[model samples]
Each structure stands twice: as C-alpha cells, then as structure tokens.
Target: MSLLTRLLERNLRNSGAGARRLYSNHAEEESSATKHEFADEEPVQPPRHQKMATDQDWSAVWPGPRTFQPSVVPLPLRQGYTEKGAPPPSKFANAELMKIPNFLHLTPPAIRQQCEALKKFCTPWPKGLETLENCEKRFPIEIKSTDYCHALPTIRNPEARRVTLNIKLSDLKFDAHAKDKFLRLVGDRYNPNTGILTIVADRCPLRKQNYDYAMYLLTACYHESFVTESWESSKSEADMEYYSFERNKSKQSAEAIINWGQPVEEAKKLNADHGFAQSVEQLINEGENVYNLGKYKEEVLKLLNISK
Candidate 1:
C-alpha cells in the first residue's frame, strides 16, 4: 500500500475507538463572589498534592486564577511565532564569497556535506523513496543516478544504495552581465514517490554564503502529509522555492512574501524571462534594424518570422 493509503487507513481505524480524545478541555467551577482575604494561618503549611476526579495525584500549580483559566485558549496561538531559531543576521552579512571563481569548489567533505543537505531537503520521504523505476517521468528535468553513490548521501548517513547526482560546475548556466547567476541542476537523483525525477541543484553555493535567489524552483509543500517526517534539523519546508531576485522585489505586494511565503511569482518571472521570453524580446527589438540592412535585405527579412 502507498504510505498515504496506509496513513489514512491507520487514522480511520484509530478514529473508531481507543484513541485519545481528539480534543480535550478542562472546566473549572466558578465562585459567584470573591471571598475577602483571610487572616494568615498560624502555621503556613507546605502545599499539598491535589487529587480529584481524574484520580492522578498532582503537585499544585497555578497560572491565571483557576476559575479564570479558560476551558480552551481564547484564540488558537496558531500562526504566531512559536520560536524561530535562525543563525544570527550577521552570519549572512558576508556576500563577497561569490567573488571567488568556482565558488562551489568542493573538497571530499564539502561534496559529502552538500549531498547531505540535498537529502535533508528531500526528506519527509520517511523511508526515502523506495521504488524509483518510474520517477523520472514526472519532473520537468531528468535526474539519472550517478556513480558517486559510494561517497555521497546525507553526510549523517551515507547509504550504499543511495541516489547520486554528479553534475560538474561547468554545466551550470551563468552570464557575467546578468543579475541572476543560479546554476540550476539537472539533479541526478530520482524521487521514489510520484515516479517523477526533478532537478534541484545539489548545492546553491550562494545559500551557504547567505546570498538567496529571487527566481527559483517550486519545492515547498507545507500542510502536506509528510511534514512530520523531516529527517534533518532543518524542516522539509527548507526545500521550498528560494528566490532572492533584484527586479521582482519591488513588484511584490506585502502578501506575496510575508503571507504566501514562497518565491512563486518571482521565480515564474525569472525563468520566463531567461529561458524563452528573452530570446523573443531580443528578436523584437533587433528585427527592424537587422531587416533594413543592405545585402541581407527585403527578401530575407520577409522570409523570416519578423513578417509572421
């Protein structure tokens, strides 16, 4: 059975009986009138354990008045920050690391470290995708298993049967004049689920240097079934699209960032511009100038799509 199917069946079985109450509330009896402060007792007694209907002995504890404590929180504290432990802001102030050519030069440990980061990003797969024979059909890019498996996997635990992606830095696309310099992966690992292989760069050298991208892949799946299965200290949410774009930032509505939270719009704009639209724009702007030229003139220009 699929893990999802198994989970649903397990939930259904537990729902019928013997499960802890899905929601529990404690009610306290309220007094109609506040009693006046009593004279101090001749001997202050040490607090005693209070045992009542539930039959478990408990040490006396107090927060708000026992009666005032609500049977349930007045409003769910949901969506408010519980805790966000991020590296200190200064840790990211150093953006000059990219000044070094081949910013992703990796030692053996570094490569292993990056592979581990990739696995962590892919986590919440629980057992890690088990069946991979059919995965490459789904993602937009293809990822074949690589020969580097013996040296890779999450650094925490390198497995012999693990998937490997051994792309060279030279294969990544970059333009010295362009603001966006991401090296998108044709990542080499296949996800066992959905049978679709997708490319997510094994290492965004910039992320390690605290330089984020503005145009990126769409990888976040929050409120997902596997959210609980994060395998590393970083949650699976870390796998979400990360775009640190310069141009698109000004167009962002407040909600596009703080609310929707992924780089969806920015990434769309980016890939659109670079992959296809830029060529179209170049053709549109230069066509008239090129057409009015001498030898390669009217007939050639007419035959070209400039007329179409």
Candidate 2:
C-alpha cells in the first residue's frame, strides 16, 4: 500500500470522530435548553391561604364547629412555643394549632345562617305560651342538661349521670300542715325565698335511673306529706320547730286588748280583723324593729279606732 493513501485514510477517520463529538455536544446543549424552557413554563402553586380573597364569605368555608384548618384561613397566624426572642412558627402546616378545636364555623353570620336553615324543621311556638309566666304556669317542671368534651377513646362524661328536677312549690296543692311537712321532708332542697323545690339524684350511675329516682323521691314526699300520723296530732305548739303565736297567750291577749270592755258582737267584729291579727303576730314573732313596731301600732289603732 502507498504511504500517502494510508495517511489520507487516517485523516478521514480522525475528521469523522471530531464531527461526531461536535454533534453530540450540540444535541446535549439543545436538550438542556428545552428542559429549561419547559421548567419556566410550568405553573407555580401559591400558598393555599393566599388564594382566599378578603371579600370571601367565611360561613361558606366553615358552617359549624370543627377541627382547625390552616390552609383555608387567610389570617397570618402563628403558634407553638419558641425561644424567648424568636417568633412562633407560621400557621401553615402547624400541628400545634391544627390539633386544637376551632370556632371558625361559629361566627355570628354562620350561626345565624345555620339557625335560619334549621328553622324550617322547627314547630311554631305553642298557643297561650306567650309570656314566661304563662309558660311557667303551664309547665312548672324544669329539666336541666349538660354537655362534655373529651380526648379519650370513648366520649363519656361521669357528670352526665346527674339529673336536676325543679318545680315551684306553689304548683303542688297542699294545706298548711302538708306544706310544712313537705318542706321538712325535702330539707335544704327546698328554697323558701324562691318557693322552689330542687331535687338532684345522682345515686344511680345512669342519667335515666337518676331521673327516675328523683321523680320517685318527689312523688313519695308529696304522698307522705298528706298522711296524718297519730304522733303529728299530739304535737303541741311548744313542740313545734318554729314559733306559732296563734295557739299561744299572745293572740288571746291581743284580741282582749282590741275588744276591751266590749260586748260579744263587738268582740267578734274586732276578732274578724285578720290584717290586724296577722300584723300583731308578725310583730311578736319577728321581735322589735322600727318597721314592725310601726306596723303593729298601725294595726292596733285600726282595730281599736284610736287616733295618735
């Protein structure tokens, strides 16, 4: 073979290798540029809360009490403890804040809207139940309720077993003796100021049992109050827990003073003064006070027709 021919072949092979290397470099550059362009054209996802507009209705986002949601809320809130001088972590992806309950769904407008929506399922107010007095007269019994929240496996509150029953003492018909007996039987559960009887029964573990027990207690007291035991009739005025001037020397003395040296008819007329008798009794039992003395003096003057 000729040397020149061999050298030309070597040169041709070297040029081809150089061309391939140049082509490979150009293709790699083109591929890298295409990737950069595609990356620039891709859509950017902004923070979820940033999408919320100022004019957006919060009621639509949350309609009731629920777990806290950070993404949907537009507020720039932060939570979790930090160093003394450091700010708290941002609300986004904040486990400490999200784990707690939120009142976002309980906004005034949301509550109003929820109530309006629920109104369609409610019944109209009953007739003749206009005033609170009228309602109380119709339904004197009041039942109490309670709610509880827990972070346990089961949602049970021990206090939920407690049941309260209240009713006006006036609602139950009773004579003076029966009423006194009922008051004594109920002990401190009866409120003299409000004339209400409050019965609380927590002896049972279940609420229904406790409620039933309270009802039984009330019924038993009412029935037992009317029973006239032989010992009850034998009780004298001195044996009474409280003072009663009616069966004492005070009533007779007061009547005698008001009807002094008068005939039977006049005495009967004077004795018929119930207001005077009541005022005199109250004054005697309650002891001396300016108001009581004034009231007693007024009653005595009215009964005897004396001018001061």
Q: What TM-score against the true fold does each predicted structure earn?
A: 0.15, 0.72
Residue 104 displacement (Å), model 1: 36
lDDT for model 1, on a 0 to 1 scale?
Answer: 0.33
CA-only RMSD, every prediction: 36.6, 4.7
Cα-based lDDT for every prediction: 0.33, 0.83
lDDT per residue (tens digit) for residues 1-308 in model 2: 69999999999999999999999999999999999999889697886678888777888777667767777778888888999998889987798777766667778888788889999999999999999999999998887857677555566788888999999999999987888899999999998899889998888988989989888999999999999999978887878766555667777887778678778784354553677767766776788899989998887788778998
Candidate 1: list runs displaced more than 4 Å.
Answer: 1-140, 149-200, 204-216, 219-308
Number of residue pairs clashing in candidate 1, backbone atoms closer than 3 angstroms, sequence gap of 3 or more or interchain: 9
lDDT of 1 at 131: 57
Candidate 1 structure quality by residue, lDDT tens digits, 1-308: 69999999888988965443533211111221222223333566532322233432221222122221212222211221224785332212233321222212344555565688699668475343455633322222333332222222332332222332322233333343221112223233333344333433334333222112211331221112123333434634334333222233322442243334355565453222232223333343345455334323433343232563
